[model samples]
Target: MDTVITVTGEQSANDLGVTLPHEHLIIDASIWVPDGPELTAIQRRKLEESVSMENLWWLAAYGRQPKWNSLDNRRLDDVETAKREAMRFVAEGGETLVDVTPMSPGLGRDPGALKRIANHTGLNVVAGTGHYVRHAHPPRIDDQSASEIADEMVGDIVDGIDGTGVRAGVIGEIGATNGFSDHPNEKTVFRAAAIAQQRTGAPITIHPPVHYKEGHDVLDVLEEAGANLTNVILGHLDGAMELDNASAYYDSLAERGVSLEFDTFGRIGYIASEDVCFPLDETRIRELRRLFDKGYGDQLLVSHDICKKNQLTKYAGHGYDYILRDIVPRLRRREFSETEITSLLVDNPARALTIEE
Candidate 1:
């Protein structure tokens, strides 16, 4: 509650410069990989070939396929590659990035890796605790009680991760699946996350389902568990534009006092619903302005939810610097004053991520 826990060491929230509140420097997720011993060459080629333009569109509109999963593209294992990307973000006026890589196995369970990135690139980093989505968690999570899960999450925040003595500053990127359904495992984790938040005072960032109803359902679970709604950040709202009643939906959330994280700036291609017909950035900006118009400016945050290799510069995706390089200027041109921009980029992050304990 007193200081923001950075990978380097504890520091004042005032020192956390323009921050990307909901992003990941290294997210090695094997969530969607089809289980197999090994693929034959033809099978491997077929799997690789399955990732076509149409396939991505299908993924955006429909759901995951048995043959077509983003397995190979889900890893950011090269620390040097991540370091190069972090420096790019820092150089372009970004000071800190809260990496929501959780303690889930096969993902970002190693706090040492985050510490290494911060120590090398001199970028302030904050790691996360708890499991991610249901599919991302290990099988053991299903058998654990809520208190048990919360204890482990607290350990990740207070003790360390992977026995490296590097603590997590946040409790999530805790996840809910389509429609934010109260899947037993997801509900259990949500309850555990709320208890962890109440105990540790670290902010909770939720990876919400894209459906409009799912957002509110997630809040319901968090609130029922007595989590402080102010510190509860509902992420992935940029893609929520696919909803027809996006305005009213976001308004309701903002009024409930949760932070609205428009964390996917240049990530329009990664749609999940069939309704995204507008230009990506334009739709995002419009939706953002609606939130502001509804008097939710102070509770807003933005970032690039970069989780794939193609999302890096070398792989033809917009690098980590894209938000600063392209989006900020566009906001200025769209008549958002410097003061308004500062509130979203600077002030909101400091306040939202700061524990209320």
Candidate 2:
């Protein structure tokens, strides 16, 4: 039987109930933080303070401004806080959470911490193995060949991550930006992921660029590198649905047999901080219906992708239970059957994450 590897150990796929396929329990994503002279003294001080009710609105409005907001929101390193946030999902009947924090410098990927969280919460924590985008890549990456990188990833899957004895079950959210041509180091990591996937039978999930068209470029590199398209996932697709031909674009991506992960479930409204305006839940429901109507329900995955401090319940955001507490009921109202919801939350993740025997 195929088994799903967890930080604790191997688990039967049937037992992986009501899974959230993408999440981060412990992470430090400060690589995205910008240090520039554009900030005034007060703005810089505000940036240092933790996110709270008083400054939450300002942070949401200008968090990505680099010069205007706080950098504390870009980090999630407290294990106790992570444990508390994870339990919120557990209370809502969620079982498995795939923490896709890649093994890149400054982006905390801790298998020991993951194992501890699993032990405490009784949640199946599946860790990932891969490099992130260009900025997160280590300085030694220049000296390593693609095969050498793949070897490290393979070791993480087959043996353990950094001698922690906690094997990774998945191979991403390996990151890519712009297009395939623009970032050679990202491409190298992609190729390494493809190699590691073939060797270990682990699934690959990619963080593609914002442009929906550029997703195809990422697929091209993975496809050419001999990765299994069926086990590949393209994440953050919700952020790329603004163009006129988005529906058709999604259809084309579905046709390629890769799982399209719409992981930003609860992040609604305009994120002026980043100049990004995510579609409302109503719009996302329509898109799901569109994909379902086109016979691509099986090629879909969903999650909250809660990576920032403002996204947690402690900061008054929706927290990890948003999908179960809010979105699932909306799907029912929209006429999505129980079987369809099961396929999305249970069956798809089980199939995508199981390591072939």
Candidate 3:
């Protein structure tokens, strides 16, 4: 049987134009580090991994300790604010924005909040289901079996989250840390996510474990789950997009009919600070061209992955807006055809999100 699955009473993929397959409008701030100093040394160490320990120690000692209060007024759950921000995107020639926030305790998992935001914004908003990384999942989940987690995930898609009667439109941002290749938690989450996909036919989007190995591991989980690989998306591919490694990863996933996502288009500063150096110039166009030349154009999706509030200002001059204002024109300048560009920003995302007419 053909593996492509469709959403109920939704528009066809063609209707989703210039869509951003991965993004965040309103994300709960608690996921980064809950507001508390009671955490042990290990907890402090783990949370500070993204930042330099020297910088953190400096802040802890001489500088004011970084508090979560900076994030207090950044809620996107309000319909009016969401509408304004989303309007900025659509006015800039963007169409759909997939709100890939997962439900976790202390994190705002309000499906009603999403619905209200979408309704007010007039943006085609896609919501997601599934747990985040092991650290983000609720303590209660440890008491449940994989089957139980799968059942809950399926219910969230088919029914509604927390019995609120609001259905999630997609199945992930399912968190796997360190990429799928090495994490045991990734395997468990993959099993549950796979079971959920099999039952609901909701397309899966991976929050790939940190590096390339995780991407490979995610594919392993999907295949094991009897998922149609084409219905799966390997997210954060750009994070590992060294020329040789990216080509191989894209080729492998494309051959399996899975889509590859380079959704961190506007995160240059944050991503640059990481150990790995991401090529921020024409490297994006070069990568796209290489994928097109390799005949994988139809399976590529692009976006900014703007999770933090600061990224919005970071976007004002050079963020998500950069994709529309800068990158598209650059691709055109490089002689990329409109069809290829469309497939990357629109067609592929619609297919992965499984929006049906």
Candidate 4:
């Protein structure tokens, strides 16, 4: 099967050069709001009430539901803005932007959207397929068989989604929550992703449930699925980078010829703010040196997993700019050779996203 699907004349993965293995142009959790007629007042209130939580003082604590306009900046679906952002990143030396927007419940699927954005932005955009986790999957997925899910994913890759000619270049951000042992859905999702990888030959990237035990479980599933471990990437390892855990994860995956991705570089306060950590200062440099010493440097890929629209508000002050400006120079100051730094930013990612013609 042909892995590359052209949309709006942009080249596919095989043509994308110096790719950032993980990143997004536009993404919204609200995109998962099921499509239908507008919700009634009573129904809307009931839905809001269910997600509302109470604090110790009995104050209603609502989770930060993103202000759709605020989070997306009203330009996510706009081609002009996407073009500017992509051009800026490319001008700054980025070649490809891997959109890991997996197929999930409530999230509207638009495989052709990337093609439109890429055509406007002049950035090589690679879209993804495969279901997320149980929380993100439509309720009906709970009762579906593994083969059923796998077949659906294969359809997304082989058959163009929504009757659009665009097809997925990758198979994840497959969500694995907690340990794979206890969670049946995580295992199911993993199995489905593995099947997608085997069928498509596109690289698979896993969003492991946690940073440790569950992460190992994801690797186990990928191995069993016959995914070319060399082409797989274990993402979100930065959350574990503070300790020797990053080394352990990288070394384990490296031994299997897989890549290790540390993409949450600039997203300091979002997502796992309390639990998520960055290896900046001497700590980051030391870790890089340690990985290089262990012969694992070639497998490391770095980026800022900026998913929110607010993240891209400023050109040079946001997104990958944070890493290219702040982090890269700091690593150099700490005696990380320019050659090594280039390999991490340019070479390693290029290899990870590269697919044979």
Candidate 5:
């Protein structure tokens, strides 16, 4: 029998309703900051940089603005506020949310925190395990062998994270930069995550680097490590998933049975390129349509990768309910049937997150 694990406990896959495939309950992606913390406002002023191609990619891809003090808004560590967000999601009909927080300073996913949110909001929150992007990795990561890393994550699945008794339900949102863009120790984590997946039957999710691409290289690595592509999902397909460049990557992923996640919905300020704006509400639907047209609907999933405080309703974002509230209605307008929406919201997630035997 198929089962979906949550922080609260195991539940029938049938009960996993309105699932958000990738999101962060409480996190801080400070590793994403350019030049690290050393490049502060004072240093920035001395550098006298206006806007360069280096900084544009951040706005173009991750939705980070050009404000002088934008870095301060990078955290969402408040548990009480997170509880309120989860409650709002539940009230708006959100049932299950995959918290893809990896291990990081002031960031990453903690199963214990997830459990607290699950208990308070009554929403089924699936917890994450495994290391994050290269920049956020622990000092021990460079020293840990692939098998060693796999063992740690296997412990997370079999036992629990931090002895809190909250077993992780998924293996990643494992960090990769730009389709395996060599983040110092990225390949090690990728291989270990693959081993852990085969060891534990937990699904894996990938968080690509800022500069997105075909993601074929990283997928190749995972496949080489014996990962089941169907049990794996390639997330943040927004800017990098363009067909014009490689054109064959999407079909390749679909043909290989890997799922594509258009999870960052409702973030409209960012632009993809001169031709398109990323996190653009309409572009998501358009891209989603392209996927469906290509017969990859069954392998598709969607969510809002809401990791910033500004994205919350208290801070005036669409909140956790934006997808079902706004995006789905737009899909309906675009001639997507109830069946299609159900596949995106309900069926695909159950398949994506289920602990396969």
Candidate 6:
């Protein structure tokens, strides 16, 4: 049987149950959250406010404003907090979670922390390898060739990350922005991730910029690098619902043999920077039903993509179990059969994470 690498160790791929293909437990993606304009004294204080029931709505409601979307809100650094939140999913029948936080100092991918979470919660935690978007990448990246980057990532996959002996099961949540026009470094990372994926046969999951029809653009780069499409997953497809001819766009993407992850399950709001508004969960469910009807059900995956502190139940947001505790019932009410749901939450993730030997 093919094995899937987790933070603790390797496991039989078939043993990975009800997996969330996209999530972040111990991450600091604050680098991705852009700095806001000059802040007033009072505004700065509000931005630094600890997430609470009184301010949770304000945090979510002002998501469009970078100042209001505080850097403090974007980070999940507390191991115990992550464990407590993740255990909620374990109680709700989740067996595995893929923490696709990109491997970089700026993003702070902590393999040791992941190991602790797995040990504590008994949640098989699969980590990723690769750099994020240009902003998060170190300055040395500009001097490094794609081959050198691939060498580092392949080492992480085959040997381990930062000498932790915790091999990465996935190659991404590799980041890109506005289809690589703004950040050429993303192209290099894409090529490097593709090379690493080809070397290890590990699945590559992409974090495409919100609302860009870069699905094929991204695949083209990977294909040029001889990456296997069967082992690729493009994340945040829920953000594509607003595109013109969205269903047909999905049909073309499905034909390429790459899985599409409709993550961002619980987030609903506007993003001013991208001018993209996250659709309601009902809209995502409706789009999912449409995709299923078009026979693309097998190509689908789902997750809450919980990375922010406000997203934790401790802050009055939907916790890690949102999909199981809420979305599953909603899907059932929408007439989605158990088999389809199982494929989304279980079989697809197992297959996606399995190393090709």
Assess every candidate by TM-score. Answer: 0.90, 0.96, 0.81, 0.78, 0.88, 0.96
Candidate 5 lDDT by residue in tens digits, 1-357: 798778888888888999998988878765554544656676455234333344443433444533332443466778998999888889878999999886544575667778888988888899888888776788898798999999989998888887888888889888886546555489989999999999989999988653456477778889999999889998877655443553365667678888888877876654323344354678678778888988989999898899876677876577888998888889999999999999999999999999988
For residues 82-139, could you state the per-residue lDDT of candidate 4 as single tens digits?
A: 5676777777767677888788855544666688777776766777778776668778
Candidate lDDT (C-alpha), each = 0.79, 0.87, 0.67, 0.64, 0.78, 0.87
> Which whole-number lDDT from 0 to 100 does residue 149 have in model 2?
96
**TM-score, structure 1 vs. true:** 0.90
* lDDT of model 4 at position 338: 82
Task: Spell out the clash pairs found in candidate 5.
Answer: 101-109, 102-109, 178-209, 263-303, 271-277, 271-278, 272-277, 272-278
Off by over 4 Å in 4: 1-15, 30-79, 210-213, 243-246, 269-282, 315-317
Model 6 accuracy (lDDT, Cα)? 0.87
Residue 177: error of model 1 in Å? Answer: 0.5
Writing each residue's lDDT as its tens digit, candidate 1 over 1-357 gives 457877777878888889999888887765655656564564445445433454454334332333444565666777888889899998898888899988788785556778888988777898888878888888998689999999999998888876888888888999888855648899989999999999999999998874444788888888999999999989988667766777788888888999998887776553232435323887888777777877889998988888876677866678888988998899998888888899888899998888666
Candidate 2: tens digits of C-alpha lDDT, residues 1-357: 779999999999989999999889888876776666866778778868877889999766666455665668878888899899899999998899999998997898888999999998899999999998888899888888889999999999999999989999999999987655788889999999999988989999898885445888888889899998898989989887765788888999999999988988876665555555678878888999889899999988999888889889988788889999999999999999999999999999998898865
C-alpha positional error of residue 345 in candidate 2 after TM-score superposition, expressed in Å: 0.6
Q: What tens-digit string does per-residue lDDT give for candidate 3 at 116-234?
A: 76666566677788888877878777567667888888887777778777777777888887634555655777788888888877888888754444566677777886777777877
After superposition, the stretches of candidate 1 with alpha carbons farther than 4 Å from their true spots are 34-70, 270-279
After superposing candidate 5 on the true structure, give the runs of residues whose Cα lies further than 4 Å from its correct spot: 35-69, 105-108, 179-184, 241-243, 246-248, 270-279
Clashing pairs in model 4, backbone N/Cα/C closer than 3 A: 32-106, 32-107, 83-121, 176-209, 177-209
Which prediction has more favorable lDDT, 3 or 4? 3
